[model samples]
Target: MSRFSPFSRSRAPQLLTEVLSRTDAFAPLRAGVEQMSAIRRDLDALLPDYLAASIEPGFIKDGKLALFAAHNALAARLRHLEPRLVADLQARGWALDGVRIRVRPQAVKDPVPPKQARMTPVGAAALQALSEHLEPSPLQAALAKMAARHTKR
Candidate 1:
């Protein structure tokens, strides 16, 4: 007869710490604010699914978390459902300071469109044409500025 043990080959605990990165997530959260860019990608890759786009954890100030919902829809859902979310994260060993969600109206302004421009060859041609043809009028300059700011060079 084979012995059954939690440490057995088939039943042994996985490398959970390595898998989930048991080190404090506070570092990434803090670094995110300083960088101010690439936050979505960092969070998307590291954070758990339930808290990925659904919740944004801020800080551990005064033993409280300042969280933000990515959109109004998620905020609305969290306003009444945070307790459960919190419970689930807690079960997964997430020691968060109570979750607080702030609704982001702006993030919902253009759901389908990418906030950052990802131009194809055709879009690049269109831009080059506009740049060459458009005169340096105030309106044109403003449009150019907007395009430059939004498009990742």
Candidate 2:
């Protein structure tokens, strides 16, 4: 197939690989991404399953590895394991100096809960009764209005 074959005929993975590798501008970025991915795999292999899932590997700069945790609790756990982790990484051939753990919570889209009725039916009835007993005034009017809102037809 021609190098410029239509996307319909060429697989996305092959096209992406070709573009990332062939472009001089993308070569360094691709290499950096690959290195980070490799580091992440190694880190995950060394960590416990629960910890591994919450930790993300960042770039290694100036002989130090940057790690991102899902929350402060995980970051604290990582800090406690920093010395051991650094040693392990060094043993695995990384010229590591220290570990930097930063909390970077993942974005979660949680649906808002439906609002609950603030005034219960019984409370509404009580307000209505109190308003009826009170003389005609702003307070009585306000109470009656609020009760009307909460009471069922």
What TM value does model 2 have? 0.61
Which tens-of-lDDT digit does each residue in 1-153 have in candidate 2? 577748657454665556789878998888888888788888888999999998899888888899999999999999999999999989988888999788999998699999885987889999999999999999999999999988854
Q: What is the lDDT of residue 58 in candidate 2?
A: 89
RMSD of 1: 16.6
**Each prediction's Cα RMSD?**
16.6, 12.2
Q: What is the Cα-based lDDT of residue 141 in candidate 2?
A: 100
lDDT of 1 by residue, 4-115 (tens): 7656657556654343455576566545454333434444555557657576656545534456777777677666766765665556555655666676543434457546
lDDT of 2 at 90: 91
Clashes of 1: 0
**lDDT (0 to 1) per candidate:** 0.58, 0.89
Q: Total clashes, candidate 2?
A: 0
